[model samples]
Target: MTKVLLTGASGLLGGNILKHALANKTLDILPTRLGGDFSVPEAFRGDKEILPLDIRSQTWLWNIISQWKPEVIIHTAALSEPGACEWQRETAEAINTRAVKFIADLCEHFGIRLIFISTDLVFDGTKGDYLETDPPNPLNFYAETKCRAEEIVASSLHDYVILRTSLLLGASPQSLRSLDERLKADGEAGKTMTFFTDEYRNPIAASVLADITLKLASGNNRSVTGLFHAAGKDKVSRFELGEKLCQKYGISRQFYKGARQDEVTLSVPRPKDTSLISDALLTVMNFPMPSLDEMITALP
Candidate 1:
């Protein structure tokens, strides 16, 4: 049985990963949450050994690492909100970069396999089909932090896979409002929601991403150490995605407008296209990557 330590168990992707990992009893999962509430699927509640962890604290992390020596550490915790990260640059840097550096140091010292989750926003998005070999040019503070974190992981350990993913679909256990849900709510409220037609991404369901992550972690392949793009096969703009969501959920399409990227002003610069090509991951795993339609269908 492989002992796995998963961080950010209360979050969207982390919760989904925990739910998936629980199906395989062979995986002894010790999920670390910020507080008492372990908000994963109820079916897998009994399967998890919850541990309270403050990922920002290096001392706390060291203590946990020393006490519970896990074989693999799936890092999912981060200050993911772009606006929040921009507002709280120091906090974001601490959580995203400094914390990752701490984890890398501990993992390297203990010979533990590390699976670092990264974002496609690391790219400047000038080119849509971003390859794993492509150079990262982060435009926002959040992306900058993740890019730095990726470097920390790469330089710190030989046994690590820095998986860069894109916009995630599917309902999270945290019940945090997703982009689709927000769009629906705005439409219901008789408000105009302008989606970007120029900005593009290849979004994947959280469950699908979690499944792929578990597969990689299960392989325990030391050779699979480097950056890999794990995202949807088809590239679509936010406008297209919004249209699909409206069609699928019976939302009022009239309430939204297809605006270009330059029309909107944001706290930080957003990439025009960060859609990733998963050729590197697909070559190794024989499974088909989900299309935009397939991902939308999987959504609740």
Candidate 2:
């Protein structure tokens, strides 16, 4: 069995990874999380213990990595929220960039393969269909940190896959982790939600991403190393996605409002169009990237 170390087990993508990994007999997965109680839904927790890990602490991280001696380490833990990252720059750098550097060093020392999860926001959004070769021009601190982390991973590890993904839409283990869950929560709470009509992204299901990650972790194809893009086929705005969620969940349209990027005052500047072209990874993996409609339909 391939012993895999998965970080951020309580997060959306991490939870999906754990859920999918458990069913695969080829993988013996050890999941870890930080900063809170086990927030992953009980349904996804199939007798697996989620260990506590503060990736910011080198000693704590080293203990886990050295003791576990995993064949593959999927690093997904991050200060993902753009607003939070902007407000707390130091904390964001510690978790997103510095921790990744340490992890990459550990992977190098132990001869373990690393699969790092990055973001599409690394681009400036002037261009829509971003390829793996495109130079990153991050507009926000969160994206900037991820960009730096990507460089660290690339320089530190010879056998690593840097999968840069777009907006995620799926049934996360927690209520607020995925787009559908957040929208549904807002609807149930009688709150009107405003989405940016100008901003665009090729959002993918977290489960699909997890599947691709496991394929990399499975070690079936070692040639699929280096950077790749993974996202849905369609380029859609947040307003369009919000409308779809309303229709799918039977929520009222009155609860949803569409606004341009300028109309919203955010802590960080959001990209206008960060749509990714995932053909590079899709071609090699022989997996079809889903459409926006398909992604929404597939959500549980």
Candidate 3:
């Protein structure tokens, strides 16, 4: 069995990846260095080992590397939420960039395959149709760190895959509560939502993204050790995504207005377009890409 060390086990993407990895018992998954807390999902509870780690500290990292000695490392740990990352700049830089570099070095030393999860926000919402090869124009420190990590991962190990994903959905127990609070506050305050019509992204269901992530991890690319766009097949505007949510849950759409990018108060600039479509992801499963509406409406 190939031992895989999964970082950021508490995050939406990391949690979902843990779910998918569980079904395949042939793969040994060790959930480690979860940032804040350890909320083990049912899928990973009985079958896997949970290792509490602090990726930022070299001492913490060395301990795990010495013990786990994993054959492959999937880096999902990050201060991903933009506002949180922005507010906690030091923590963000440490985990997203510095810790990731540590993992990359370990991967190189241990001769293991590395899979690093990145984001679409690396582009400052200026260009829409971004490819793996496109130059990154990060708007915030969070994005800047992720981009830096991507560069380090690309160059550090000869065998690694750098995947950039979009916003994650699908009822993350942690994330859902936050979303509900934000939406409820907005609804109650009668705050008019000005979602962008011009800025676009292809937000993939978290579950789907997880499955694709495993497929890529299972087949660690040697020749394809570079950046990849891990997203849905079609692109939709933020306005469309919000509208879909309101319609799906039967919320009043009165607060929603089709606004352009310039109208939004983005603390950090967002990409005007960051829709990622890949034949690589499409090839692994028989599932059809779910539109934002279907994903929202079918919420369990």
Best by TM-score: 2
Worst 10 residues of 1 by lDDT: 36-45
RMSD per candidate (Å) reads 1.9, 1.2, 3.0
User: Which wins on TM-score, candidate 1 or candidate 3?
Assistant: 1
How well is each residue in 140-169 modelled by candidate 1, as lDDT tens digits?
Answer: 999999999999999999888889998887
Q: Could you give the candidate ranking by lDDT, starting with the highest?
A: 2, 1, 3
Task: Give the C-alpha miss distance for residue 113 in model 3, angstroms.
Answer: 0.7
**lDDT of each candidate versus the true structure:** 0.85, 0.90, 0.74
* Tens-digit lDDT track of model 2 for 1-300: 999999998889998999999999999999999868545666676889889999999999899999989999999999999999999999999999999998999999999999999999999999888999999999999999999999999988899999999888777777588988988888989999999998999888999999999999986655579999988888889889889888998889888899988887876788899999998898998987777888789887
Q: Candidate 3, residues 1-300: lDDT per residue as tens digits? A: 768888877667777778778888667888775555546666544556667888878878878877778878888888887778888998899889998888888888888889888998888766676777678889888899898998899878788888888866675535442333355457667777666798788777777777766766664433355567788666888777777765555568777788886776777656687776655545544446666666555454
List of clashing residue pairs for candidate 3: 125-270, 125-271, 125-272, 128-273
TM-score of each: 0.94, 0.97, 0.87
Poorly placed runs, candidate 2 (over 4 Å): none
| Model 2 / residue 178 / CA error / Å | 0.9
